[model samples]
Target: MKKITGIFLSMLFAVTLAACGAKAPAGEDVKEETKTEDVNDEKMTEEKKDDKTSAKTDLNVFAAASMTESLEELKAVFEEENPDLNLVFNFDSSGTLKTQIAEGADCDVFISAAKKQMDELDPNSDTKDSDITIDPDTRFDLLENEVTLAVKEDSRKDIRSFDDIKTDKVETIALGNADVPVGQYSESLLKNMGVWD
Candidate 1:
């Protein structure tokens, strides 16, 4: 976990530094030259053709619904930098995304809020379902989150914490469904506290 966190931080730092750099002034003429005369012109032409083909490719990213806001913000910056590649996002519960992938939905990238969903798709994991292929090398923890109890400001409930919710002082409670990562976490917490029935 520490290693993954470190890698994520490093990547975030690199992206921040790159985004801060100034771009070359507009209308400036830039010259290009071959590194060596031995370079094959045909190979170069073929590579350029491949690049053009790939430029029209659409990258489908399936991610948890909770990441919608942050991913949407990054989408604008990423699209501006790589105009040729279009990123199509399908945001939903992690479990739902996993089911989509299992059903052979087109996805170039998958970001799950919980490791459970990712594990189910990871070919290397013990919990993995057969037929799903995931590149383990590209997998890394992106962020950590906390679950908290919230109440309306005008509410008269005397809830102060998870334990408080177990008391009769609170009448009704709202929680995410089991398929949602937040819901799973909340359920786990409540179960651990001997409050979930």
Candidate 2:
């Protein structure tokens, strides 16, 4: 019985010693994960800094459909002088451009196709009342455009001038929107020519 008790105590002592030496693997794994996280965090911060440095002061310009070709040329010249300044253009009808500008789009400038809609905003070409996120006085008319009543190519209809559109069978005329500058000019031209009746 005494020998058996000694053996049992020796086994218990060995188990206690082994347990004292054995550390939880969980702690080591947690440390390794923390190291990995720190590395990722450092990498992400560096990437963010690089992006900030590379980012340019891009200026967004919305122009009229007719000014598409002309504006592209202007953009090239403007960008050359200001290399760090990027010029992005959105060319479309005046009505479309006005609505976008009114919605408070993040554009630096607006070159409206039609002065009528743009004039409704203001001389500066800003948005009307209703939550304007950008600067109010960021719009201006670069130049004026004239409108002419043009007929389709190779049409046999005798469309000599504005009066010709009023004649019979000239009903399906393709004109710009009323608020569009060209459309407004066209309307004025027809009214002055006494062909609106």
Candidate 3:
């Protein structure tokens, strides 16, 4: 998995370089825009004059809302490491990000919060829309997060576990939206515990 993650990061950097009209070098950074002029008899070729104009100024990345802090830190490091490229982030719910990509938004990378949202963007997905297609080779599980139960830091509530949510002592319980991945997991857990009807 570490090897795969390294490969994936390399691919992302390569893509960034390609987008900025630069070829990936061996452990070297692209510091400036390169312009190649085709001189025919000491005169610049018209077709090659404006090639640098096509160099992308930004690499757009769509990420889950939960990844905002981490991605922001990465963006800073990435931009500092690759001076020629800028990373632009679009953070939102995984489902929303998936929808945006399906709608033809310009995205160089996508980091989803859930497997269902990512799977829906996969080209081989049976549940995905026919018009939406993502190369299966480019997909990988990058992170895994555990579902946790939390309460206010200073609260006097006696809630300690899932079982406590059903007790009369606990007045209120907070949960994610039913349509989201977190909520789905919570629902499944409750049902398995025989607490969900």
Off by over 4 Å in 1: 1-55
Against the hidden reference, what TM-scores do the models get?
0.70, 0.57, 0.67
C-alpha lDDT (0 to 100) for residue 29 of candidate 3: 38
Ranking by lDDT, best first? Answer: 1, 3, 2
As for lDDT, the candidate ahead, 1 or 3, is 1
Candidate 2 TM-score over all chains jointly: 0.57
lDDT of each: 0.73, 0.61, 0.67
lDDT digits (tens) for residues 1-197 of candidate 1: 10111111111111111112334455542412232222456556666666554555467889899899999999979977876666778999999988887887777788999999888877779998747556778899999868989987887776678788877888877999998899999999989989888
Candidate 3 achieves a global lDDT of 0.67
Better of 1 and 2 by lDDT: 1
- List the candidate 2 regions with Cα displacement exceeding 4 Å: 1-53, 123-140, 166-172
Off by over 4 Å in 3: 1-56
The all-Cα superposition gives candidate 3 an RMSD in Å to the true structure of 13.4
User: TM-score winner among the candidates?
Assistant: 1
